[model samples]
Target: MADSSAPVLLGCDFSSSPSRRKPVVLALGRREGLRVQLTALECFDTLAAFGQWLAQPGDWVGGFDLPFGLPRELVQALGWPEDWLACMQHYRGLGRDQIRAQFAAFCRARPVGGKFAHRATDGPAGSSPSMKWVNPPVAYMLHAGVPLLLDAGAHLPGLHAGDARRVALEAYPGLLAREILARRSYKSDDRAKQTPDRLIARNDVVHALEMGQTRLGLRLKLSHAQRDALVQDASGDSLDAVLCLMQAAWAQQRHAEGDALYGLPQRFDGLEGWIVTA
Candidate 1:
């Protein structure tokens, strides 16, 4: 049985605009020493539903697959507020069209490969630029996700201060997946692209996590059914959520060792929040 006093650990695979077909997926779990157990997986078909879930009373720590802050260079170049909270507030007011226009203008002025300004964490975490409006559209993820965290009163370590009972960290599941799979593709949203090779890759990733083969030195505990479910999902959203859950477990361990920043580096940039395990 799980400890009654342990805080709930969460890993979220978010979508900026969620629908029944592409909902935000959450992997709920708990940690006992170096082992993290997969307890449940839930999906919310709308941002409002997800936000409601966030506001519910609970003791939890979550690793969300969304940028918590914008890049410092981009914010400064665009003449936005320098302080993290103020900048987020400023960003929240703009329409999506306005945001796209401004970001597009910023990119058009620069060269091809280096057009987008990146958060310091992006390089180490191997994540897409937080300001990119296309492809992954992470800028909108930040836009839609951060406000929900803030409104829920979750503490964000280096960024905004909120409820101590609830903590939120920016996490990138790709970081863990790459450590195991090493660029072998594991999933796809497009039905036509879900090949057998990807299924094998997903199996490899799940095996690595179960065996604690990653650098984090934390093993994942899953039942036989749970293991099969993770491997069978072609979109990889559930597996991505599990990856974030492991990151959250690592952060919780750091907290237990008396690091209030929850495994984030001491020299973290306030404007460009650090990825938890990076």
Candidate 2:
């Protein structure tokens, strides 16, 4: 366990529309030397509740699974604001159908194989374009999430500055999950698709994290029960949140090591936010 006075760390698995069945998962943890202690996992059953949590004043840093910004190409094609904050404001003003139609028209103009516009960081991060409105509905997520962070006064490292004491960064758990499991499908929202092999894969990923086998070089300290909880959730929400927690820990370490951007590349695009590990 970390010292009682250590600043809190949060990892969020967000949803555009959170529900009792698919609630937004929040993992709370702290770094102790080289180990990240898993302290608690909570679920916000509604988007409003999640925003309410962000609204509370807390000295903390966070890794959020939602995309913070749209692709530069998409934003430019739509004639949205070029500045990150202004773009978010413009984006929040539009409804889902308008956002989707704009993005679809942009895609129609692009080449077939490259239907989606990508961020510079997307090549390495293996994340979907933030403008994607389906599959993961990340575009809607950005519309739902970033505004809440903005409203709560949480600083987004390279994207937006809010509370200096509270920092939020875009995090992609797939970046870390791939390091240990490769192409092994470890999680699925479909109950029938959650097989035993994926179960073992989740266990394997957690074990590797506990042993500090990845580039992050931070071990996960979990009680036996906590370990089970991370491995048993076949949907991977809990595990993804923990992976994001590790990413947040990495960013904090970088900030402490004199990297002012907290692991973000010095030359990242202001309009297309970079993923933490990318």
Candidate 3:
């Protein structure tokens, strides 16, 4: 059995296009009393490389900023492959243009008010509409990401079954960051908004995590060197992964409370568990 007392929390900032310029940023750590200590921060240059890391046997709870599933409506309307694994495989096989054309066709068929069909997790997390192609391109993210998790055989608490040693949860850094910073946008990959103030905001967000002010009630405990490393990464990938790690910590706490399938409550509508945090 894995060490229950020191389960590692992994937070990942993934890239749809995993390359030298846009590699996967991973923050590895564990909770110590009130603090979430940073043990390591690493990068992977390809999805295949990241998948290999995820498949390794270990006790880890991870929050990945990647969509876990496609919108149900899209699945049904596109007449796409049904099995989750097959669906993702088929989707991934298509070129970007083909994927866009199919998605666009589905959108054209849907009514204006219901432009996006949702995944079971969406309602609870208040996540971006899965149909969105830009801004976050989460729909495409689902296409790019979910298959790797499934293939790696990781367990998606509340969604799919696999090895318990590796738990994969969908997380959104924007949600946690916005909760504290509200409307104060920080570090964008877009060069137009990469101002010093944005960098300062990102730093302030990290400081806040270190101080334990977010809803997770978990402070970031980092060595001076680790702190310096996180601060030095201008891309904000390491910091984003740490933020996801905190969210995973919160989900783990909730799991201990008997909500084994943890996620945000869906908005007042009956769509109960739309966003599976754990």
Best by TM-score: 1
lDDT by residue for model 3 over 104-190, one digit each (tens)?
877787789876677665654557876678777876776677778888888876456788777888888877888668888666676
> Could you tell me how far off, in angstroms, the CA of residue 127 lies in candidate 2 after the best superposition?
0.8
Model 3 CA deviation exceeding 4 Å by range: 1-5, 81-95, 110-114, 118-126, 262-278
For model 1, what is the alpha-carbon lDDT of residue 182?
A: 88
Candidates ranked, most accurate by TM-score first: 1, 2, 3
Clashing pairs in 1: none
Q: What is the C-alpha lDDT of each candidate?
A: 0.94, 0.91, 0.74
Where model 1 places Cα greater than 4 Å from the true spot, the runs are: none
Error of 2 at 172 (Å): 0.3
lDDT of 1 at 200: 98
* Residue 60, candidate 1: C-alpha displacement in angstroms: 0.5
lDDT (Cα, tens digit) per residue for candidate 2, span 1-278: 48767678889999999999999999999987788888999999898999899888778889999999888887777788899999999889999999999889888988889999988888999999888999989999999999999999998877787787889999999999999988998999999999999999999999999999999999989999999998899999999999999999999888878988989999899889899978
In candidate 2, stretches whose alpha carbon ends up further than 4 angstroms from where it belongs are none
Ranking by lDDT: 1, 2, 3
Residue 251 Cα positional deviation in candidate 3, in Å, after optimal superposition: 1.5
The estimated TM-scores of all candidates read 0.99, 0.98, 0.85
**Ten contiguous residues with the weakest lDDT in model 1:** 1-10
Model 3 per-residue lDDT at 202: 79
